[model samples]
Target: MIMDNWISIKIAAQGPFDLKRTFESGHSSFPIPLKDKQDRWYLVMRPTSINTVIITRVAQQGSNLVAEISCPQRELKENEVQSMKKILRTTFGLQLNLAAFIEEFKKDPIAPAFELYRGIRLTRAHNLFQSLICSILTQRNSIWRWNAQARTMAKLLGEKYPVGHFLIYSFPEAKTIVNHSELLTKASLGYREEYVLETAKTLANKEKKLEKLKKVPTNEAQNALLELKGVGTKVADMFLLYGLGKMDAPPVDIWIQRAVSHLFFKKKEQTLAVCRDKLNEHYGKWAGLAQLYIYCWARDHLK
Candidate 1:
């Protein structure tokens, strides 16, 4: 069922929401939002079950958000619309209830960070395969470099759709990636090329196994992700937190380790395991979100 024009949908945020802060929170794994001349933010993506490129113009309206979504290449079905709504909700953390976490940590040392990045939310990847590849790319890599590589990969291999005067791309599927594995080298993936291709082959062969992690316990999912090539503790934690929505998995990168050391360990160097345990003890289920905030704050203030 193709519509003649773009369809509009309204989604209500469960709590305080800031579109700008959430979309541009410096999470390299998440797709970057493009701003038009009118300053409207638009994100282009594809539903997991369909190849049609969906374009959404997101705007904040009071306590609710408006997503003016359209399938530029075809008509969107009702079920696809529903799936898009769910994806948007998860991507923006629209259903996250942070009231208790905010109130409890309002006076803590990281409290200033909470205020500084008040409306920011944990932004997840569009899919597990994308997240896994991104985690591999980020290993021993600068943020700018990895992000560029991701965008280049998408541009070269992803499906492109023309919306209005602009052209946008949806991240390529696993099979497409597997078939076009050689193109990845052009993206400058370097040593990560083998890991990414092998991961894509696994996803193409056993996608159900990867998707099943979303419903499993955090520790169990982390263990399974660790079995994949190029996945270490940090990469496994990243995939669990950002890909599987396991909020208890705190990704202890260098920035987060430094933040935890200074704030909780009195400037003493702490092991990554120690930082993870401290974050879990202090923040509990919200440890992943806390890690995101601390990472952003440290990147800005610590340097």
Candidate 2:
């Protein structure tokens, strides 16, 4: 916990926890507007599960990015903290090492300059119901379609927050969505609706017991997440990686499958076993970090 003059902290070139992306993925809260806000990503950190909820603008200052941390639980110790600085120096870039990783990217600096972020975070689900539902929407569809389903569902269930023109909303909970489950199904979820309801119901039944999942090992956590319908390996990995905060967890969606094929496997005929081995060998437990960087890069660069 570091405390310093707010202005000086803001301009410190780099800091950890300034990660522009949301720890949780389902929410529209982390606004990565296409063109308007180019220099920084507007994001809300630690929104639901954690008390560290704050809307902050994330931008790189010098070598490390900086953020205006706003969690109520944080007591910025009078002792100026350097923990933030350390995280950035270690996590940024794709080659995996901080400064070393940056040098690897220097070979093609343009892409790394704007999109990639560093650091490994252990996040509480942020919003379990939201992620569970979004995972359902994501099943068997392209990311584009998945986002559309989630957006529509959010508008249906979320309570709009008025922040000028930025109309963001919090994702609805299982208890709340239960009342409107019919509308959820009717909106093209079709067969997947059962899985969505089953997931929500399971969470609803468990209540706070789901917190115990965090203590369970990653394998157990992933297995439990999959027991509920609609939760396959990728969705389970989503909960483990984003919700339970497992680092090495990587959800091998079709996009990742294709990307791995192009970069590592070099053949459409490669076996899934080879893909898993290569991914595991390269990234180990931090596979999610590697996945995200490649996923982000592939989204923009891949043919």
Candidate 3:
């Protein structure tokens, strides 16, 4: 009977929450193993120290959102439910205010591009560790390949639970990866195995440093992340933007490079340096969100 009870927590959508728009923004396009059926989207998190898999079903009900939180291994405790609520809020951008950014979008030079995909916000990982692992997996690989690698790693390293006929794996923690370093090989990480291992070890050893890094300025955070393995400029920017919630960081991938060149520079001859400076100047604090909208719009329109 305890398992039968689905703890429904209501999230205020007065900030104009758009579930579909959030996923469509391309932020959720990563291979994070988000399972959806009909209107209910399933998300799994391992928030507890004992590797408990918390399964949450989020759905839009009218203007607000309801999250049904559960745990297959055990009944969801109050603190566990509260932690799920916090993680869900972070993942869904529930606490973020987009009104100011939306207003600024009106005067943006790429206003049409941003308007085409409005209500889009950055969908972050459950934590900075997850974001760093995802960034390492994504480097120099096709979207398909990186997604596959991520799913494989999760299946091998993460805790999973059965829901009806389906089994979903939660995102693995740094300790999980640290213990099963051999599993990274099983996940087909190839040359990225060392980077993944080193990253996990670094996180495991440097909790205090990571905490200090989080409170620093964006430029300092970027520099700190760059010191990690397999973290180049783009990966550092990705970690800052999506992981640390620095909206000013515009991650310049190849597609974004081409998109910014065409839109702001008027041609493909613009360098990445020029493109980043010009766009940051134009959008200011909204640079990262603007990048997401412009990238999504350009992929749809420019192609």
Candidate 4:
């Protein structure tokens, strides 16, 4: 019989962490995270290594974050619990030490952003496949539209689990997506449907390719991701940063391009390649975090 109890785990941040800023940052491409009246954040995800869906409730307890995880379909095992901890750590960037980056960029044009969005971390998606799909969905679309599409896809394709009085869905697996390709049309993906299907097929057959991206160098990983359908330079870089945790890969989208041009190029238009190169040259390994701060700052101040 399935257990009704929740397993609680506490995770310590390496330096400073802000649970509210990180969860509401709007930096990630995953479906919007849910927060209840009690200030608890809820995430429904299926870790790649685990066989079941996990519902996690995260709330800040002093300096540390406490996660109450539940597997409604079955009893949570020891190995799965360990894997959940690792996944939560990765997803929330609990182990990242950002003191150096903050100290280095304290005087730069993006410095004000650091103060405004303090404790905002680079949040990752559930897994590589989900990241890839979310990247594809963001192409030529606004954040709200793409997020809605992703949520719709999850509702249509993902496994439904009961959490309290609510039912949540896990992001569908590649094999599940491959089997349900027709449902992509219903998700309002438009032209992205074909790309999502092809990518899902590739992942379903050779998922190790996606897993291996975590071990490879940044440029090589970007190249491999670029080979997939609907993946361009921006999409590849997005996957690199958010999917595989490559901090040096900063994606240059329209918003980032505008921000970079304004701050570094004196509002003069520059090519995407040049903008990306400038970010790499300036921030080096901290380019991804820089991009997030600048992007958020630009969205507010630039417009």
Q: Identify the candidate with maximal lDDT.
A: 4
Residue 123 error, candidate 3, Å = 1.2
Q: How accurate is candidate 1 locally (lDDT)?
A: 0.78
Query: Candidate 1 vs candidate 2: which has greater TM-score?
Result: 1
Candidate 4 lDDT trough over 10 residues, lowest sum: 160-169
Judging by lDDT, tell me the better candidate of 1 and 3. Answer: 1
> Which lDDT tens digits does candidate 4 get at residues 1-303?
232688999988876678887766667847666677888877787777895677888899876889999877777899889888888888888767767788888899999888898888788867667888999988898888888898888899987766555666778889999998888889989999999999998889676578888898988988888888888999888888888888888989988999999999999989999999999999988888899898889888877
Per TM-score, the best of the predicted structures is 4
Per-residue C-alpha lDDT of model 2 across residues 93-133, encoded as one tens digit per residue: 21234343334444532336224444422233445556556
List candidate 1 segments past 4 Å from native.
Answer: 1-4, 49-53, 72-74
Q: How close is candidate 1 to the true structure, as a TM-score?
A: 0.91
Question: TM-score: which is higher, 2 or 4?
Answer: 4
Q: What is the C-alpha lDDT profile of model 3 across 179-282, one tens digit per residue?
A: 88877888888888899899888887454455455588988898888888888888888777777677777888777788888876776657766777766888
TM-score of each: 0.91, 0.65, 0.85, 0.93
Q: 1 or 3: which has the higher TM-score? A: 1
lDDT for each candidate structure: 0.78, 0.52, 0.72, 0.83
Better-scoring candidate (TM-score), 1 or 4: 4
Off by over 4 Å in 3: 1-3, 14-16, 28-32, 47-53, 72-83, 205-211
What is the RMSD of candidate 3?
A: 3.1
